[model samples]
Target: MELTFLGTGAGRPSRLRNVTSAALKLPAPSLSVWLFDAGEGTQHRLLQTPIKLNRIDRIFITHLHGDHVFGLPGLLSTRAYDGGVGPVTIYGPAGLQQMVECLFQLSGTYIGYDIQYVEAVEGVIFDDGNYRVEAAALEHRIPCFGYRVIESPRPGRLDAGKLKEAGVPFGPLYGKLKAGEDITLPDGREIKSSDVTGACIPGRIVTILGDTKPCANAVRLAEHADLLVHEATFAAGLEEKAELYGHSTTVQAAEAAKRAGARKLVMTHFSSRYELEDAVQLVDEARAIFPQTEAAFDGAVFDIPCQC
Candidate 1:
């Protein structure tokens, strides 16, 4: 799995930053891409990366803020033009379907592919065989949600040595045994899979939050996460402004990471008022409280190696 930041600016676009957008790439056997928050100019930002727009199968919007969803209509239309024949599912708070429908109606745009809109609530929103996504309401101006992405534990490795010791011939049967199936040998002896397999390894967990102030739900969503992507829209000294705007400060984001026991903190969605140097300072402030804090930049990519 990997995360690519397409835009990191909070409210509006600046020379140094764009609006909020991110892509989470999961490798095969599930070659899938997930998009979070398509802000203004997201389609333009995506053009800068090597990612194919047609590969995005799921999109999760945090809220109805202009900066968070302005690019949805254009991106969807472009996807249809680019020969995206597969179905795409979008999950967000209430009114998302109406908003997209209104945009299509106003523009007279017709899509060839099927699009499904799901109204997000506080619970498990999506669950496939390999991963599950859960959401919780955050304290924001609107009904914003933070997502917890948990990968399922992988199967154990095959013990070649044990198979050799048992005099089992190497073939498709080895694969079945490694898959935890009991097999009867040629001599009528039963071989148990657990005897020739190593222990199952656990997968990594990632948490991503939308715009919000310091709240219990943020901490809960980030609990024990391998990586916590939280919004840091203001510096430590601007706590009052952050609260007034229903956003989080650097210190507040750091405190949540520290309390949640997150291994790493990635801060994004910076306010336009902050310069490049000021953004560096904001990261430093968060790192002072939580050592593994980093501020995200446009087109920045982070590789997450498989824990198994």
Candidate 2:
């Protein structure tokens, strides 16, 4: 899995950053990508990267802010033009369905593929075979939500030596045994999978939050995450402004990561006033509290290692 920051600016676009958008790349059975917060110019940003628009299967929007949702209609229309055929599911707060419908009506745009819009509350919003996504309400001005993407634990690997010792021949039965099933030997003796398998490898957890202030919900959502992507819209000395604007400062985001026991902290959603050079200082401010902290910029990609 990997995370690519499409736009890292907050509120508006700047020369250094665009807006709030990101792509989570899941490299497994197929090259699947999930987009989070498709801000303005998100399709344009995706064009600049190696991401294919047709491969995006899911989109998660945090709120109804223009900076976070204005690019949806355009992206949907462009995907239709680009020959996208599969269904796409979008999860967001209440009113998302109405908002998309209104945009399509106003623009007279028609999509060719099936687009499923899900109005999400504070609970498990999506669950596939590999991952479970849960949302929690955050303290934002527009009922924003934070998402936790938890990967399911993988089955244990098969021990080839043990399998050979158990007289299990190399065939489809070996596949079944690797899948945690018992296999009967030629002599009718049953061999349990646990006896010939290694320890089950745990999956990684990634938590990404939308625009919000420093709240307990954010901390709880990010607890024990391998990667915590939180918005840091201000510098360290702007705590009062952060609270007033329903956003978090660099220090506050880092403090949340520290409190939640997150292994790594990635701060984005920076205000346009700060330049790219200023991001180093912002990262330093966050790292002062959480040692493994970094600031994300447009086009930045983190290649997460697979646990299995």
Candidate 3:
């Protein structure tokens, strides 16, 4: 899977960044896109990337803040205009359906595709066997949530050479062995699945959080995640202000990643006060605590490898 940032600024748009939005592009078999938050100009940002609005089958909103959801109505409308007929599922806090319906009613807009709304709840919100998404409440000014996307573990590749050496015929029996089933040969010998198969490759875990203060839920959602996207809305010196505004400072974000044992940390939702050049200092402060930290900007992309 690959993660693309549409907007990274906090509260409002800046010259270098927009607001808060990110997209996760899933690989083959389920070649679809999942969007996390849709701030203003989110559709415009999608237009710049290769992802189509139709490919976005699921959208998870973190909160009802203007910076997190102001562009949702526009994005849904444009998806219809762009000939997106596939069903779309949106997950968000309470009043999400009412808010969107109210906007559509006032604007006299119509959607051509089917839209499903799932009110945000603290637990496993979605599980399709292949992937599971868990949501947890976050410490923000208002209601906010953090999501953890976990991919299912995949079976290891079958060893055809080892099977051949073991006098097993290369046919449907190999398929059964690959499926973790024991097979009995015509010679009255039994072969275990683990005898030829390699170790299972573990799945990847990604945690994406909304604007939040340093809290336990944030660490819990990000625990041992392959990639953790957390908000660093302020620099180190502005810790008090960040906490007051229900946001995390650069140092605080890195500390969360460290506490959670996250493999990599990508900090977004930066304060507009920091210009492009100032990002170096902000990320440097974070890197002081957690070395595997990066500051996200608009159009930034991070590819999560599938292998364990």
lDDT of each: 0.91, 0.91, 0.94
Residue 306 error, candidate 2, Å: 3.2
- lDDT by residue (tens digit), candidate 2, 1-308: 99999999999988778899999988677578999999899999999999998899999999999889988888988999877469899999999889888889898998999999888788898888789999999999988999999888777999999888888889998888877788898899999988999887788889999999989989999999999999999999999999999999999999999999999999999998898999899999998899899899999999777566
Error of 1 at 131 (Å): 0.8
User: How accurate locally is residue 131 in candidate 2, as Cα lDDT from 0 to 100?
Assistant: 90
TM-score of each: 0.96, 0.96, 0.94
Residue 80 lDDT in candidate 3: 94
Q: lDDT of model 3 at residue 284?
A: 96
Model 2 ranges off by over 4 Å: none
lDDT of 1 by residue, 222-298 (tens): 99998899999989899999989999999999999999999899999998988878877888899899999988999
Q: Rate residue 141 of model 1 by lDDT.
A: 92
lDDT of 2 at 232: 95
Location of the lowest summed lDDT over 10 successive residues in candidate 2: 299-308
- Which TM-score value belongs to model 1? 0.96
Off by over 4 Å in 1: none
Which should have the higher lDDT, number 2 or number 3? Answer: 3
Each model's total of backbone clashes = 0, 0, 0
Quote the lDDT for 241 in model 3: 100
Worst 10 residues of 3 by lDDT: 77-86
lDDT of 3: 0.94
